[model samples]
Target: MATAKKKIHYAWWTLVALCIIVGLAKGALNSSAGLFIPGATQELDILTGNLTLYFSISSIVTMIFLPIGGKILAKYDIRSVLIVAIILQAGSFVAFGFSNSVWGWYIFSIPLAVGGVFTTVIVGPVLVNQWFKKKNGMALGIMGAAGGLLGAIAQPIVGHTIANDGWRAGYISLGIAIIIIVVPTVLLLVRKSPQAIGLKPYGADTASAVGSDGAKEELDKGITLAIARKSSAFYSLFLFFLLITSIASFAIHIPSYIQSRGYDVSFAGNAMGAYMIGVLLGALVLGFLVDKIGSRNTVYLAMVLAIIAVLALLLATDSKMVITLATGLFGFTVSNSVGTLAPALTTSLFGSREYSQIYSTASLGLAIAGIIALPAYGYVFDFTGSYTPVLYVILVLLILNIILVTFAFRGKKKLLTQGHWN
Candidate 1:
């Protein structure tokens, strides 16, 4: 009798879909926003601070939507939700091109944030958890690295487009491209659960078969949002999100920051490309490190890199190479705030049970950082005439983040001792 051949797993396909969708969502739409600022301000005749407040508006919308977005993801069809989210998110990017005033950005930022809260902030972690029963850290890292690689490509393309055709055309073209690519990927590849295809999650069987009993117990371990809310683990994770994001918020200002230091827009764009390369390498390294060395150690090392990057930026003078290298290192280390770190940290403290709710709730820190940090950086530049202060503040936050990560793990040990994990 002939034997049937084993089929390739669909989880890998789902990962590819996420990589494309999330990568484009972040690289083409979110990161590209920085490139538009100088040109947009000149044409619209708006102050930089005023133009960037749209980020604040977007953040406010994200804060309101994140919890609700979690519920929507749970209750709605994954394909349908993603398709509509792309339209809303990318469509807003296209709409920004037609606007002649800062108010346009302010208004459209709502839909942008509404859609982004799902696509950018929540979907990758949630879907990875539902699909991958092992190598979860590596999977998250790949997702982030994909964003970095795509962002590397998009950054230059966006800069060239703006330089040649203006921000208006750049925005419209990028939005159209994202919708075209992401919609089909979402419809064809993304599934809510492995059960939809009558298969167990990738690596689920091996994870169970090879585990020590302690490992099995930990897999069964988790706490509800109610319990997590009351735990120090949750709060420490929240502050981690907040501080890390506040630090990473500098990316949006990088174009302006470098320009202030005497680099041109084209050079600034190239620096961002370098930054993306850092993101790509850093994401992969951190992912592997999380599995081998653990999240806490990985986090400590990342924070130290962040401080070095900050110091390089602060002290480096007139050397474009030095500034660019510093910026790249900064991007590599700080990108983890939203990239692998959030999800990895979440898993370390909370386990898998009730993950979606806890992750979404913890992500409020992300939204809050967007609200306060982005605009604050912009306004500080507006008033103080330099980004110098911002760099110092980022360095301080990086040090503090190491402490927060330590406290968070300690909190997890308390939960374990208190029977919360049982």
Candidate 2:
């Protein structure tokens, strides 16, 4: 008799679909926004600053919509929510292609950001939490890595398209491509939970076979959102989100810092390439570390690495090679905030009981950081004629995160003791 082939888990399929969908939404659509600015401003005779105000508008909308999006995702069918989200996001990009003035960008940016709240921010972590009982950190890491790699590939293609065919074609083409690719992927592969299909999450059977009740009960193990909101853990996690984001925002000023130190734009570009590579590799390594060690330990390691990177930047200015390496190290550490660490920390501190709601509420800090950090760094450089002060501030914030992570876990202990971790 022929041996029966073992079937792969649907959770893995869900992960694959998420990799493609989120990758394109982030890499192709969101990351490519800056490439169009030169073309849009030159063609439309709009001031670059005025045209970029759409980004601020997008940020504000994202901040306002995040909590609402979290609530919606928790209450609705996952497929339907994601389908509507991609359309709003990609549809806005398509609308940008047809716009003739800066006002058009400002107006459409609202829906664009609204869509992003679901597609890029809330959906991936929430689904992964629902689908995987084991290797959840690795899953988040893979998603983040995929997005980085896809963004790296997409940027060049997008730049080429805009250079050859113009910004309008680039915007419309990429937008339509996202919808075509993502909508079907969601409909076919994504589900609200493994239980929805009468299957357990990946590794859940192993957990059951080891004499535990099952994954469903395991999934339900956590502090409720109301209790979590009242805990020190939640507030510590919130500050972690804000401060880490603020620290990572320094990436925007890196090229200027390089130029200020007498390196040319070419060198700065190469350093940025190194940084991207670090982010890609960092996601994979951090995820694996989270699986092997745990999220808290992984966070501790990341903070230490960040501290080293900052020290290298501050002290190793004489060597071009050192600067490049330090930038890459910095990128590796900071990529944690984007997707990997935030979700892992949430699961570690609060469990999956009300993950979407709690994670999204904590992520208010992310949107707030976006609005404040970039301009704050710019103004610091403008007033002082150097980025040194900003670097020192980042170092301070990095140290603070280590303390916050410690406090967060302590708060979790308190919750467990108080019987709030139901």
Highest TM-score: give the candidate number: 1
lDDT (CA) per prediction: 0.87, 0.83
User: What digit string (tens of lDDT, one per residue) describes model 2 on residues 362-396?
Assistant: 98888788777866776676568677898999999
Q: What would the per-residue lDDT of candidate 1 be over residues 1-422, giving only the tens digit for each residue? A: 13332666788898999999998898768987888887788787788889899999988888778779999999999899999998999999999999998889999999999999889978998999999988876787788889889988888788778778888998899999999999999988998899988988999998778899887677767877788899888999999999998998889999888878877677778888888888888888887788899989989988998899889888985888998899889888888656777888999899888887898889889878878898888888889989999998998898889999999999999888888875
Q: Name the Cα RMSD for model 2.
A: 5.0
- Score every model by TM-score: 0.87, 0.72
Clashes of 1: 0
Give the runs in model 2 whose Cα sits over 4 Å from its true position: 1-4, 7-11, 34-53, 66-84, 94-102, 125-138, 159-235, 251-274, 291-297, 308-327, 346-361, 378-389, 406-422
Candidate that would win on lDDT? 1
Worst 10 residues of 1 by lDDT: 1-10
